[model samples]
Target: MRLYRMRLYRIALWVTVPMALPLLAAPAGLTAVRAARDTAPEGAPSVWRPGVTAQPVDAGRPFPALGAASMALRRMVPRPAIVSRAQWRADETKRDSHAHYAGGVRAVFIHHTDTPNGYDCADVPRTLRNLYTGQTRDRSWGDLGYNFLVDKCGTVYEGRAGGADRAVVGSHTLGFNQGTTGIAAIGTFGPGTPVPAAMEHAIAALAAWKLGLSGVDPTGKVRLTSTNGKSRYARGTSAEFDAISGHRDGFATNCPGEALIARLPAIRGLAAEIQGRYARAVPFPRLAATPGNTHRG
Candidate 1:
């Protein structure tokens, strides 16, 4: 009987010791978790905070491969037809081809072709070819500088691949190339000249889609300047908003036209509303705004 009692006591001691060890380590483990949570930055997403939302817009129409929700939200401001494939091919060869882009897209840059007045009536393909092969080539650029081109009829044409509902990197500006997408309107918008309503709607829809895909907010206000090392709008703006911006913001040339530049604030406001409506339909966090007309990363 005495031997049996002693053996039971030993077994009890072993079990208790292991149980106590976990209790002892619990506090330390908790402390580490809290430290990690505290050090994590806001706006940036993490596993712990899955609720942290990016852009507020939906990525418009879905690519058949991506899914129904992956649709890109391209609304026709007007029914514009794609230029003939033959014309597009002819333009490609007649134009100077440069480096093809192979990077993910993050932002959109809008521009005006700066074509002379009355040239708007010229053949769209020929004009685009001249711009890509003639003008930009003369300046030593690759292909046409824009990823997408909008003609006077408000038709949007694919200038580069990876533009349809995917992140594509194309050459539009220096220093801002890595994560930027470029769009150019065929005609110039200046004082006394206005963009067509269809064009505006198309731009708004496309911008909303891009903003949603990039996780940026369409409604967030963006300041045009940067201070210190941080963007002033970064904290206040939504990441999901499209960085709807002009070419002059990055380069010296006025490519987006004076009239269009002046209309950006209104354009942004319209885009934000479109995105907000889309977000409400699907329910996502409103995107935060960033400083400057463009997104840095």
Candidate 2:
């Protein structure tokens, strides 16, 4: 599904069979595929409040259903809120023409954008654009490396060009990217910085829904093959990883930071609870619409 930016995906599939295996190879010729429509973008933030506390779970990170159009993750849990690439105005023209797929996701890699966390919730769209330029033009990664991004306000933005539901391979981790999804928190979360509870829950819900598509338990371990020697493992080496892992686990960089890393257990717990692997999560109530709230399951 190598679609050009601004092109309408003409071909669409209602996937029923579980697609867990060796990922499908992209076809030589360009063929468009229509995916499930993404949720509408939410209204821009009305104001910028520095160091503002995020909304609580019952109010902030509400679980939005993906509707019936979503590809079956083979689970019944509600999909987390997701803002599409269009919502963030991704410059698909800058997208790396070479997109890859991993069939189905086996795990998720967490990262922090290493940027300022004091940004206004309203400015997240602009923030995403800046990240796009840095990664594609400056870093030569071709596109935003993250498959999805989360703000302190708990909003989720679609990162790469392909549909969020699809297993579009991202250039996030060095050797451990294949068969996994990359989710970046949109702020610097070094030590002593308090992680927003909303952000953590949003990450958990997203991870739980995505992993549930493959019938994976967020609290469990997964075997992933490293594709780069520079990574902790040599190429083709099979390694064990927590279902939700920090970027430092695969690469030598202190990307997600120690504080964020320490919260992995709680995030994993929340995700597992969302998936009904443990106690069921709190029932999601319909919170009034806020400025930066929006979903794909």
Instruction: For candidate 2, write residues 108-226 as lDDT tens digits.
Output: 99999999988888788988999898887766665788899999888888997667886766778877666678999999989988888888888888998888887777887887766
- Local distance difference test scores for all models: 0.50, 0.71
Candidate 2 least-lDDT 10 residues: 36-45
Clashes of 1: 28
Q: Estimate TM-scores for all models.
A: 0.54, 0.70
Worst 10 residues of 1 by lDDT: 33-42
| Candidate 2: regions farther than 4 A off | 1-73, 279-297
Among these predictions, the greatest TM-score belongs to 2
C-alpha lDDT of residue 96 in model 2: 56
